[model samples]
Target: MQMLIIGGSGEMGQWFATFFKNEGYDVWISGRRGRSDVAEKLGVRFTSTPEEIIPECDVVIVSVPIDITPEIIRQTAPIMKPGSLLMDLTSIKKNPVDAMIGSAPEGVELLGTHPMFGPSIPSLQGQTFILTPVENRCEKWFPIMRELLERHGAHIEIITPQEHDHIVSIVQGLTHFAYITIGATLKELDFDVQGSRRFMSPVYEIMLDFVGRILGQNPWLYAQIQMQNPEIPNVHRSFIEQCERLSKLVVENNADNFCTVMKDASVHFGDTGAALHRSDKLINAKVAEFEELLQSIGKEKGLYHIYSGKTHVGIVEKVMARSVDILESGKLVNLKIENVRLLNSDELNAWKNDNLAAKTRDISTYIPENADPDTLCHILGKISEGISCKVHDTYISPDGRRSATFRIDIRQDIDINKIQDDIERLLEGIGCILR
Candidate 1:
């Protein structure tokens, strides 16, 4: 059997293309702008005109952007052979499913799929794929598709397009809306996140990390998700109404009412203790991972500076099996290795000479909106010779301005003034401003 994926250059399209090709199907991808290199890398054929490929393909998966998916479906579905299976990998199902059902030839099978995970994931293990079968004239295709997906460790959930949209309105819509609102509020307040780290708890840090992750993604896609879903307006209205009601309780200083609201919400959630236990496990795992990373660095005999989540600098005297020995202001302290970061080692000699005293500086800067965290960290590492840089906080304004606060560790030997100047210059060269 042959499979063709439209919009093959996109992340999801490439994922499907690579998967089908690996499954020994004759796989081909068609996009407006074909990249031979990408096709070669995925071991699939590529073509600019999808129409030419439609007649030959036994299965055609439309894996384009959400907004353009229906148009693509309308154009390709009629051309597909009667025995071929037609599918779409859109996030939302209703519109695309309808388009596929309406435009496909009489005997073509139609299935609308939404794979919950993105392309960065290595495999589909533990991932959810929602399948909305619009038409299944080809009786054998649905089971075949299910088996293929399950073989690769994907869990399939069958639902109608309307049901999928309703659930996603809360699952994707409300969740993204909440985070986006928090981000906007931070931007509006001109919050100094890096400066506030000394007061942050692990839970707050996790929330901020999640916000940053969302803002780092494609804004257009997220906007489409919020705007295109017909059910989202109702969800947003309900959310806003709840927020208003909560604000009224706070404004009136009604402690009893607040308690009542909390009780009601807890009851609605239905398993507070179990939820807390699960969350605690995840938090513990994160802490363990953090400690393991620091120990690995210490094992390499790398001279490094450590920072507690409190944003305080500690002199790492030694990394032990369970804890790290540090000197904070002439006081020797043992910290759980997971609670500290061995992020900087450039001025190890200077720190040693100064009796392990490290100076902490909060440097605020602005980078291009939506810069990759890894790339930004790499650039900072290259420019700052002896200073360890950690992103204490990042926020993006509504107008697309992205700002970050970095915590830099400076040793006594390095000239603090000159280093600051060098950092400013390097940042400015990369279209970033030192604030």
Candidate 2:
């Protein structure tokens, strides 16, 4: 089988090309510049033009940004053969679906797919690929596509184009729009995140992870999603209005009104369901399990929480196993364990006095020097998105160990479990061990 990916030099294109190549398919990557250097590096073929690639491939995947998708579809539509599968990997669906439908040959199999995951370079192991079936002729290729995705460890779901966009408006469009707006606003406020890691909470750190991803993603792609989806503007406006109303209630000291508002909002979230659906429930579950193990290790060590006054800061002391090496250096150090919890001062004092092998000394606390940056970023990104952690900055110790700090205003109670996984993921990103 042969696959041709447009926008091949771009991150998502590179990922798709890599995915298919790994499965032993003959993959050709095409981009505007047609440099082909990346393809050579990956031992794949490269073409500069879609016109050159479409006629030669069985499957043509367009992995370009959403804004450019429609034009590209119009341009490539002319070359697609009657039986070839024409697929778009853009994040938004409706516009591209309309464009392809309006432009494609009668017998061409046009498919609209949004691979739920971004450029994280993860295996399909438990990832989901959403397919929006437009043309009936495309149904024949659904089996082949499903088989390919399943073989590579991906789960597949089929939905109508309208349903796909409706769901994505909430799942992708609104979420990205909110994070990008927050990240931009925060950046403008000149928050010094790097300087605050020592006193930061795990939850705030996770929000930063989410903010950073949308901030780093292609702005045009993100903007296109926010703009292309007709339902998004109203949803975004409603959220803003709700915020305004809440602020007004607080300013006016309207306790009864605020209580009513909060209660009404709670009803909307339901008793057990979160507003957002799990993107990769399987991978997230695995991450949660790993995090639980880390917490367990901390608990075993009797690591108790440290506080500044009445506020919980972090864990300072833990039950030391005789076999576990406890080093006392002033420079930053990276430590890992299976489980931990925030300890009260009394608990921390007990560990410090009894179990600690030495006086509490700081070797700057962070991840080990050997951890991978990409992994660290991924973990941090997840935390930022999954837990609403507002990461302000990242820091590196003199020894080159890394750490990040996030800030959050706790006006109301929040779930620590929702935030903890991202926190641990961020630590793992920097090769730091979490206990």
Candidate 3:
């Protein structure tokens, strides 16, 4: 199957292109003002525009910015082949779905999809995918697309285009507006966000993370999301009014009335206890990882960069509030705590297998008279993905017990001293003793 994604050079577009390619489709991408370099890196074909290639594609996805999604849909849908699918991955569904219906010919299936997560997400697992499928419009393709997405761990939600917009107005619109407003207000106040972290509690730290996450992304995309959605103005107004009301309450220092307002709002907000529990879990998780880093000082630890997908395996010499200093090959590399995942032992070894040089060692161990030597070797090989074990020799020890020697080939950069105890444990599991 051939799938063409418009705006393929963009973040979400590139993400989908890679996704479809992995699903065995010959993916093609059309970037409006983007270079083909991005498509090349994504291992997908690149086109200058959607017009020339839309008819040839089995699936045409319009993933352009929200402002141009309608126009892009109109231009590409007319040329799409009958029995093929035409879809939009825009945030706002109503306008683009309308355009697809108006411009697409009778047999061309139409679907309006909004992926609630961003490109930064590692996988489809636990991600929400909103589908705005029109009645009698996408009967043939809707089930196929929904099933495919769900099979890969996407949480699919079926809703009308108008309903999607209405919900997203609060979901994306209100939250984004509030966070961006906080960021802008901080700028206006000349407040140092980094310096404020020194005195921040867990809740404050988490809130600052959300604000920074928004402020770091593309401003143009955020602007289009806020400006193009007609329903967002009402949400924004409601949020601002609520903020002003809270401010006025604080200004008047009316303790009884303020408590009444808070109690009413708490009653309206469902599951506050569950929300608090989840937030506590998040805070505890952060503290646990930080504690691990602290314990890893003067030890070989591995940290995987979330965005770059690079693994840094080195001695951890220093740990700060929001950063860590890794002594990698006599060079100190500072990494942000938020931007990296601390690798477990298995993960660290797996990374080393792909990057480090191979080394072989012959290990001899005394086995129990009744224990199977072959089974012990099998267990040893299963210890790590980076190592292979083969039974090399068997002989009698000086004490007259049966003994087996294995040739262990390690392709990972593992410290032999640390792995030696692990090997001894494996041998002892089956009543075997290490030589």
Better of 1 and 2 by lDDT: 1
Please write out the lDDT profile of model 2 over residues 234-256, one tens digit for every residue. Answer: 88888889889999999999999
Top lDDT: which candidate number? 3
Clash count per candidate: 0, 33, 0
The regions of model 1 sitting more than 4 angstroms off are 294-435
lDDT of 2 at 74: 88
Model 1 sits at a Cα RMSD from the real structure of 20.5
> Taking the tens digit of each residue's C-alpha lDDT, what string does model 1 give over 301-374?
22242332243344556665446666655666666654455544544333454454557777787787656655
Better of 1 and 2 by TM-score: 1
TM-score of each: 0.69, 0.63, 0.87
Ranking by TM-score: 3, 1, 2
Query: lDDT of all the models against the reference?
Result: 0.79, 0.67, 0.88
Q: How accurate is candidate 3 locally (lDDT)?
A: 0.88
lDDT of 2: 0.67
Evaluated at residue 66, the lDDT of candidate 1 is: 87
Q: What are the root-mean-square deviations of the candidates from the true structure over C-alphas?
A: 20.5, 19.7, 4.2
